[model samples]
Target: MMASRATARATGSFAAYTVSELTSLIRASLESAFGTIWVEGEISNFRLAPSGHTYLTLKDEVSGIRAVVFRGVGKRLGFCLENGLRVVCRGRLTVYEPRGDYQIIIDALEPKGIGARQLALEQLKARLADEGLFDTARKRALPSFPQQIGVVTSIAGAVVWDIIKVVHRRFPLADILIFPVTVQGQLAGRDIARMIRELNTQRTSDVLIVARGGGSAEDLRAFNEEQVARAIYQSRVPVISAVGHEIDYTVADLVADYRASTPSAAAEAATPALTELVNRLQSNHTRLAHSFSRLLQQWWAKVEALNVAGLDPQAVLQRYLQRVDELETRIGVCVMRNIDRVKEHVLGLCQGLGYCGPTKHTVRLVERVSHLTLRQDKQIVSFLETKSRAVESAGARLHALSPLAVLERGYAIARHWPSLKLLRAATDARVHDRVQLQLFNGCLLCKVQEVQQ
Candidate 1:
């Protein structure tokens, strides 16, 4: 048996593999065996690198495995990755060469308990709410009278027609201007936001109505996007959001100035009923007319009573004249009293002026000026002394910091000749090379005999 084993070895039948080759073989085996698989586990040791790659460990109760999601796949993920999150992943198994360990290269991932889109929506809603975008204080009141109503919706959809019809029925005099946009699919959110901004820039509409027909959550995603919500929040023109049915609400609805149940409701809210306003105005006009007529009739009745009672016109005129004479006498007495009081006030002011004559004032000002001059002279001298001391201190400090002071302490600096480059080490100059030495008084030219290091 020993002879036969030796013969087999001598025939070159033995096989061996390097570390890289073995790892490649193991990777092939793992990929072939597992193919594409779905794994459910809790994430642990989650890390996000600056390069946008995600690294985490997927662990169950019994075991754990390393996983990596490259930038391309990670960018498409709807929700943030975090430790302790329960998730389900789809990928294939492979062997990592440097670590010689098995791992999963993730292609897809989602939270196990909720749908990815829903989770993303909830997270975004919370973030925007924290930024006060959903505050009721930021909401605006719809214009009571919007002459030009701006409608943002899909032109092909029935929503635009519903808004136009409602506006026409309630307030026919108001003009309708439609800003067409896609209400579904990928470009819907961006298109809606862009139209809102453009309408604001134009300033042609008093109020804006952003509406779409009722649809599923997925179909209504355009209204839930952050871009649409921010646009509604920042709109100068008050926005009435009517995205879906009464039971449905979106981010746009929260951020809009007013949330309407439907497209028709939004249009109705934006405009006032012309007939009602006209009726109110007519009622007010009739009431005012009645009040004026009543006033005129009351005056006429007083005159008629006077005539019925046979009041003498000559006697009434004499009585009025006597009253006027008495009023004139009282007004004359009051005028004399006012004139006496004003004369007394003038006398008091004259006495006050005599007490504070200009000569005394000028003397007081001269004394103040002399005092200020003396104080200013003393302050100038003190200031000069302080500045002189500071300058001397600064000069001393500068002299200590000067390189010539170090040279006076017997330290010399060497440099390569001609180039004047500083030589910090012996290796800087080779044997027989020219060098210059800087000293306290002068520089010395020399030749490098040897280099120690």
Candidate 2:
């Protein structure tokens, strides 16, 4: 009995020591596993919650792992988080206390190779800059008063309407042409490029604006495509790019002749306020009138002075003649003092028609009248000539801008007969429908006898 009790006591002591050692080892292992690790992957399933926490999945070619960057760490990240972006993340592996599952708690993140989109943008910018596409010298100045503005954008999008409204508000005289095209998805870039080329070839517009409203990176990707950028660079007409919000930048923006912060801004840049221009013109007219009036007054003063000086020349001649007559009379008075001197002098004056002669004054009055009449006639002729030239020049300019000029240049305008609106396509007229054909000389009204397939 004594030997069995001693064995039982020894077994209990050994069991307690084993349990304590295992517990210590497990604690140490947990500590080692929870330390920091570096991971590289493309971002996916990114979510930023209202609670200021971010959750995302990082995946490589084979596997993905869940990660969370609390509000504190997320706030420290300078760039925006987006899916498909390759990045390197620094974080620690930890088990969620509630679910008891391991996840990465990201403390920091940096773009892997500067991010794909950013790298592509930088490379394109460099290439275009080298080709002088982005050179300020190559950029065409926006028209101060564009008569016809063409817009290239999606037909269904609000951006087109926004541009129209803004342009109308700023310059009602400007004619707007909407060139509808796809602005998103796979074929959007090609559609835009095609429209730009067509407008350039036709010379249908004074200026072209490629525009779209703001959206996420993917939604705005069509504007960043190289094809669209090349189209903008190759355009014969000046192009204005209005792709997104003020902070956003795209390849089209860099290649375009001008960049506007938004669609409305693009419209504003394309045209000017008619009302403000009118006000400025009125102000200038008033200033010109004031300046002309001052000049006229100065000229009138000079003319009046010349007329007074011419009139006084006769008075100067009269004074000199009077002095000579007085000297002769004084010399004669000493020789024949009382031999009827007063009577003889009176007879001589009567024969000479007096010192201030009516004949000379009459001649001066006639000359002055003739001079004034000649000046008035000259002024009238000059004014009429100036007005006639101005009218002729204005008529020539208006004729040049007339739509009929296009028809005169070997072009025909097809219009719907009933509505008299220009027909853009042959489908606008039916097989039996009548249509109006406007040629250079005259209009021809024709009824379709047969439809051609």
Candidate 3:
């Protein structure tokens, strides 16, 4: 049998070690063997310590392993670690020297199946949604045919290359302005955002293509960044986000004007095909030419019909000569007839002149004026008499309702002297408050002594 190091520790003569020394060796061997590995289990007894260390046990039906994620790694985890949540943890395996036990020191964590990147994506999506970044109202429509397309993506990748190829092939007239940017890692988000802003400020593109090729969730993190999403939202030009595969989505994709499943799709969406445009132009030209030809033919037909009506200028001219002789005879007859009719009309008008004379009209007008004056005078008198009676009746009723009438019956009215407020009950006058007793003759101001209700 081989003598193990742990067993040799028992025999001091054979270079034995203390308990602490043995634990250190075991910890080093375990860490070295499993530098970084993934372990899957459901979390149990999850606890966050006051010292900012998370202590938890990862367990399956058969066995369990202890794990601790320090404050640094825990902060990076987008989701909260809770009891019974199934997860896959990545870290170095080693023994805890103080407890003389082996466990994993978690460097990173991911939820099983769906992965850890989703947690960050979900958190960002929720945050952006609350700010109304995903509202359909904020999205703009892309230009049907963009004069210039601004491409924001990494030039080194196939993404920009595909966009250029597609745009050039489909619509050569559209100018492609490439705003190269990093598409991944920590700095990628800032670069992407900066380029988007630059394109907007300069108005470089009629429409923008924020593109990238397919990538893992982690590799696509830059597109999910709030900065990139906000930049897309704030862009004046319409933006089409072509990020990752068809199955993937990001904050940028949601915030952009349109989402393309691939870079080629984005190019196709941004502009119309040149061939289709040419075909439409050709059709329009044909319709216009046909219309012009039809109009010309109609005018030509009218001219030919006029020419077909055979008539000599001499024959038409003789008709005019005959008509002139007829007009000369008509002028002689019409003049004499018109002069007779004029004389008859003038004689009749002379007879009617006296009927419309001023003297006759004035006498008739004076008679009408006298009759109207009599009618007006009678109406005014009748109206005045009725108004006078109404006034008298109203004055009599007003006298009866007057408060002074009650004083005339020997019933006095008591009012607060200073305020002139009528007092109906003794409770209204406080002791020593000055009161005014209004009688038919005069008013007497007095102070309240003993009140009786």
How big is the RMSD of model 2? 32.0
Model 2 misplacement above 4 A: 1-113, 310-453
Per candidate, the number of residue pairs that clash is 0, 0, 0
lDDT of 2 at 253: 88
The CA lDDT of each predicted structure is: 0.92, 0.86, 0.89
lDDT of 2 by residue, 296-330 (tens): 99998877786777766557679999999999999
For every model shown, what is its TM-score relative to the native structure?
0.65, 0.45, 0.46
Measured on C-alpha atoms, candidate 2 has an lDDT of 0.86
Model 2: lDDT of residue 406: 80
Q: RMSDs, each prediction?
A: 7.8, 32.0, 20.5
Scanning candidate 1 in windows of ten residues, the lowest lDDT window is 1-10
Model 2: pairs clashing at backbone N, Cα or C within 3 Å: none
TM-score of 3: 0.46
Residue 359, candidate 1: C-alpha displacement in angstroms: 7.2
